[model samples]
Target: MPLSPAFSSILEKEYEINFTQCLPSGRLKYTELCNLLQLTAATHADLGGISFTDMQEFNQAWVLSRMRIEIKALPQWKDIVTVKTWINTLENSRSIRALEIYLNGEKIIGGETFWAVFNTVKRRPEALALGHKHFELYPDLKATKESFSKIIINPEKEEVFEKKVILSDLDIINHVNHVKYLEWCMDVVDEKIILNQKIKSFEMNFMKELSLRDQVVIHENLSDNSIVFSITKENKNCFALQLNLV
Candidate 1:
């Protein structure tokens, strides 16, 4: 759909890499970067007139489908970085959002995300009301990197750890928040891997929704200095994440 004449072109937010957001290496943690990305998305959505609360009123909500981030460099503790995000495309009940993270006036990270609108009552995907004036207010920004593809599961992977979904992991929708899964995946990986290598890219595919009743097992497949992690519930794939190290 074409953007409205008055649509905003972009949304940007600045954040400092603080101690709490950094890893032992003093760089932004993988999970923390994901948190920043999510926060930026929500803030931009609010500016676009579709905050989570706004969707909840209609018994609807937004769910992340997949995401990929290419990191050229990670911001260190006390370094100021800016995150810029925009809607790149919206169609077939899916919205593509692009993000760019800048450090010291230079681009350091590029990210792409796909989200789908869900009907809370029916527990299924729903088409967005793009014809609505508010939906037309999308930015013209594009991603610095290309979109990611599906992450394949290799059953030969080894089980890394198991975790239970607790009340604190649940979001307002009563489901395990997607960011929590990313944190679980990161925790299962060896800290030495994160400290000794620079993460070149990270991608995640959320295959199925997880809830408080779920007990998940994390599995890992290592190859070529890259690791692929998958969360399983009752032996079924719940989500898969891939991290490429340099």
Candidate 2:
């Protein structure tokens, strides 16, 4: 697949917020916001000729490794938001992408994501199968005020709940979707905090992948200003999320 003439190093896409994508307060749900960011990134890759459809020819796909998001506000239902995305760096088996969300031309959210090329059939990380040189990289362009960080899981974290991965949790790659990890942790959060939009920023680290029917445990560590959640499988850490409150 060749790069489409419509492709640009920096891609911007507009999305209309519908009712289902919103929370009870009419603001967009966090998970839905993430979906929009990933969707925009995917669209950019598609137009650039390095998308899943192109890489799957060699059994490769992009998988998220880490993500950091800072939010000033959340858009409400019926609002039209623009998502702008670009690659900060892309080489070998890894890439760094930056994305921002705008409402009525005002920036409201910024996100930075780290992705890796994974061989689906071999089930391991690998270099991208397709060429990415057609896409220009902007190493200095950063979306978030703070870059992605290593989330430290507190050893004293309390076990919250446990569940088995279901079909709904799996994505196109036949593994648990990255966003599902956030959804799981978010479900155990205080409803008041979520509805009040007190989350100033959040970060997630995907240490390992989980498949359908995999049993996992959720753990929580609470502090004055932040909440950390870690998911473990068979006593091994699989994912971690840290939510910073306003």
Candidate 3:
């Protein structure tokens, strides 16, 4: 299918990033960055997607699946940064998009998001080909496979999660956002824990949706610097997160 005109026009939207948003460690906080990215995506919907052009006549929303955020230096609250985003492709019911977060002339962050547009009435995925007028403006899109490794959790190490679940860990989805769960998993690994000294990659299999009031157990272990992570509730596997900590 051809690219949507709406997609191309949204690339012109203005975006700003602040330096004060950085954490005590001098890096951008995880959730803050995620929220900004969400905002950026929302703006694109307004300017590009046909779903929003019709307003009340057409009701739709995008759901995020996989996302990768990389930053050499995170901008704080006061630091000014410009962001440019583009829709890349739609294949097999998935849409891939690229976003560049820059600080001054320096490129600080380069990220990509995996999304699927859902029809409000049907509550299911929508076909990008049906977006006739939407493709005229968004012409510069090339489909490409995402570059990242998948991480797997080790079952033996997961026994550690026999503990209780607390209310603080829950989120709007009733389940925790994957990144927050990652933040928790990452905290368990210390500098001295691995001799391999490098994180190659990680992956998550969201087998079951997590909801509020549901008990959760965090299971983890260090495997030569690469830690395996898994979250369970009542012996049923809810989520599995893997980290390649080199």
Q: For residues 52-136, write the lDDT of model 2, one tens digit per residue.
A: 9999999999999999999999999999999999999999999999999999999999999999999999999998878888788
Root mean square deviation (Cα) for candidate 1: 3.2
State the lDDT of candidate 3 residue by residue for 178-223, as single tens digits.
5566666656666343222244344445555555666678787667
For residues 1-246, write the lDDT of model 1, one tens digit per residue.
233343464777999888999888898888888889999888777666566777776777789989999988888999999998877787767888898999989999999888999877887898874343455435456565656877878879999988888999988777888889888887767788787546789899988888886898999999986889999999999899998888
For model 1, the stretches where C-alpha displacement exceeds 4 angstroms are 1-7, 130-141
The local lDDT score (0 to 100) that residue 244 gets in candidate 1 is 82
Indicate which candidate wins on TM-score. 2
> Model 2 compared with the native: what TM-score?
0.99
Q: Which pairs of residues have clashing backbones in candidate 1?
A: none
For model 1 the TM-score comes to: 0.90
- Pull out the clashing pairs in model 2: none
Task: List the candidate 2 regions with Cα displacement exceeding 4 Å.
Answer: none
